[model samples]
Target: MRYSIEEMQDAYDEINRKERPLVAFGGALGGALPAAALYFLFAQIGGIFLPMLLMPAAVIGIFARYTGFPYRLKPRIPIGILAMVFHFAGCWLLQLNPFVYLLGPVCAGVAISVSKVKLSRVQEFAIGRAEIGKLGPNKSIQPTAKASAD
Candidate 1:
């Protein structure tokens, strides 16, 4: 069956809205750590501009790992681009020492991934809020009871 233009457009929009904001944040943060560390150390020996050199590699590596690797083998999806962006902000915007920058993301990822590490009740609530909703606005139009029973 053919879909009308409106149907297709609506479908396209729904998919776009559901995308999580965490991917870029995470990668940028991850990359920032290494970049900053290298930059700082190199700044001492090579100069200010030199140590910051590794930033590109960090960004690219994080992007490749989070965005590319998982998808290549199978399917690819991100929780939220927000996390990715946050991670980047922590590293670059915050100017965390490289070592310090690594701590937040590593710990944060582990806590979110393993489910063993404890988080505050409030913290858990915040994360839970981030979890995706199902059969909701971002999804395709589904038949209701009336539509289905007809």
Candidate 2:
């Protein structure tokens, strides 16, 4: 299956429109925590490394749920990267198996890419509104009409 450049560009634009820095950060942390938790859980299991299996799904789910799922490569890339970095940190600090460093991030990237999930229009609106809340009230702008009249 081949995709045209226009299709890719449109997807990028759509994703950019939905992006909120705070939401992205929240999503990143949301995904990261699970991987960290799972890593610890596996460590308790005598280094079974089974927690790695859940990393991809957790990354995909948390990110998509928290951030507006634009189904574009750009948005998912950051989530995957964040999740991977978190996973890597956990592994390195805990001294998990060497292979997990490679596997964890790769699996997250693949899962996010293949998920084909997207945000509904209402969900997108809600996320945007929530983002505004996180940004705090808009105190930067004053009433220009009054000043002009005065």
Provide TM-scores for the models.
0.28, 0.53
Go through the candidates in order and give the clash count of each.
24, 0
Using TM-score as the measure, which candidate wins?
2
Model 2, 1-150: lDDT tens digits are 343334433444465575564465466666666656776776687656455555545665556555654354555666666656666677687786687677675666654664335665544453344456621134222334654655
Whole-structure CA lDDT of model 2: 0.56
lDDT of each: 0.40, 0.56
The best candidate in terms of lDDT: 2
lDDT for each residue of candidate 1 in 22-131, tens digit (9 for 90 to 100): 45335544555554565455435633442243343444345535532221111222322323344455357545557644444443343233212233344333333334
Candidate 1, 120: how far from true, in Å?
A: 41
Cα shift from native, residue 85, model 1 (Å):
12
